[model samples]
Target: MPSLLEVLKFLGAGVLGLTLGVEGLSWLYRRLKPAGSSRISEVLFFPCESHCMESLFSDGRVSGDQCVCGETHSTALQSSPVDPFYRMLSHLLSARVSLDICVFSFSNFELSRAVLQLHARGVRVRVITDRDYQTIQGSQIGVLRKAGICVRHELSRSVHMHHKFCIVDGRLLLSGSLNWTMTAVQSNQENVLVTDHADIVAPYLAQFRRLWEANDPARHTHSPGNADTYAPRHHGHVHKGHYADRVKGLVHRAEVEKHTASNGHVYQQ
Candidate 1:
């Protein structure tokens, strides 16, 4: 076996070489693609628990569409519905002007790949997350920056940018409580909605811009002030603490629904 130092040196060299190669490829791709050529199109979504996810990640093909007589027929690609995550990846890859993302934590391999793919395609991608959670995603950000994506963190000390959102080309907005974490998709109850409406996208763009524009401060220096004070207040308790008033509110709503159901009148919760 090689000496310990030699093995370490070899591994270091391999990592350095891979990083350089990815950066070089990204540079070449940017040189070839003209800027501002891609346009914003329609947006789509799939509920986090949608069965479509299994089909998307499955190795087996759907074959074709079933006709009225039960015969499988060739289906047009354009009409085929898209998986939500794939649609998100497609938007990132097709971005010409910019791709902006804000999340709490991102460790999913597929998401990282999409970000790298878009960066390699020459689209400007910017990511912002909580400072405390940055180290959890440091490797991903390093890969992103090396591929020419600008990455940063939220400056608000108390809030931690609990928001999960993305803006594609400044025209498309994705928002909700769904963070880029695996649990959020595969287990935790979460929600996300994509909207092409300017009214929705504009405000989120502004919010992201506000957070992005803040200067990066030195660690252990900044103070988290009344920033969290604005958070919604609640009376219910949580496992970590009485925090997450949002979830508390959801629980309260559930109780109210149960109370109403006990009555004779049928009502929607």
Candidate 2:
């Protein structure tokens, strides 16, 4: 019933109203969304070295580094179905100085191969694991031992050395519910937290040292072919000095040693 000009004007106003309403709703939604909401898909499996390596204890408070201690970042494959094995491999491939690992179980060949490759490239690699799991059919401890990677097993047969953590280059720490196994990577529900916070890394490093020293290879006897006869191409012990320097500011040496001593009574298998 309206004239042509009036009809056109009415339609134009309706279109303009709809556009403005949509824009307003979008703005409100964005304003209400939580921080890091957009980063939900960026599962954190490794520290971004350039952005995360700065010490967090500067001025006695957490620094501006992207990877802050206690600010947990997680990686999982169960819901998304991504290849967690390769994701973990990518992290190991980034190690430059050292890799310290403590896990309850390990059998994934691809992950073990990545670790062997890292050792071959001159990274100092050490592993602490459960004795029972080490003897499993696909366990990689034998492969690691044959390659001269220092590996130790828990001395206590009753208690399992159930820890799933790895420290890379003394700066980044990876820990979570995930075990180093094919089932964990391929189908099991698992998660990994990666960070470069020195405080978090220090305790784990101390624990690893305790376990490593307790399960000293010199004190234990090995089968004829089990001894690591291959001397490293480089002076790998020098890397330990580098690690010491890295943690000096974050954790007191004496404090760590005391902590280690207090818990050192636990025998390794």
Candidate 3:
């Protein structure tokens, strides 16, 4: 029989191999991400400035309607989307290959619909959320899963998966204080930082890969994940679901429900 020291060395080698395998997976994931220039890089503040509510492109100086914080960005206004929320939605819709979402809660109908649309289009979509909030009323996790999207949740119940960020086509990284909930979008003061920088996006990609594997159903159940996929439909067939119109889907209610901000301060919308 092998001595204790020999067995110990054998176990150590196995552990080292596991580490290398995980690292190899991360490297492959990065290689698969289509590289591109960082065209969209900006931090967006919630409760957008009043200027965002103004008319779009009507100004002779600008081309398309995009919210431009002239005072902060440079001029009073120039060429940019005139609305912040619309910009967010547009980026979400821009995903063509893959979209990954890591957030605490997802209840906002518009955002959920956007995710569904992406899934319908063959874009591989994955969601990682806290276990508790995934089933919380108004959550769209169920909706997403029902549509054949892969959704994972935290393994522990004592702690929370409170991350609020998403990656589009493995390029654009959207990280911020905003949750994918109605209150976060239309009421609470939140912020979302959008960027496509490789250095920044790489770390998040690794973290997501870690969480996804850690929370894998196979890991927990020792069985392969049988994630559902959207069934093929007839040509030109579309899911006849209707959602509220674009960015300004709902009026930003001045009066909002009570909630706790990230700073631990209790406040109202």
lDDT per model vs. reference? 0.59, 0.64, 0.70
Order candidates by lDDT, high to low. Answer: 3, 2, 1
State residue 244's C-alpha deviation in candidate 3, in Å: 43
Give a tens-digit lDDT track for model 2, residues 140-194. 8899999999888775433678999998898778888777776666455667876
lDDT (Cα, tens digit) per residue for candidate 3, span 108-227:
776887888888889999999976566555678999988999998876433579999999999899999898876777677899999988889889999999989877765433213333
Candidate with maximal TM-score: 3
Which segments of candidate 1 are over 4 A away from where they belong?
A: 1-79, 137-139, 216-269
Q: Each candidate: how many clashes?
A: 0, 4, 9
Candidate 2 has an lDDT of 0.64
Q: Kindly list the per-residue Cα lDDT of model 1 for residues 232-261, writing each as its tens digit.
A: 123432223324643554465466556656
Off by over 4 Å in 2: 1-83, 220-269
Residue 49, model 2, lDDT: 22
Which residue pairs collide, candidate 2?
154-268, 154-269, 155-268, 155-269
Give, for candidate 3, the lowest lDDT window spanning 10 residues: 245-254
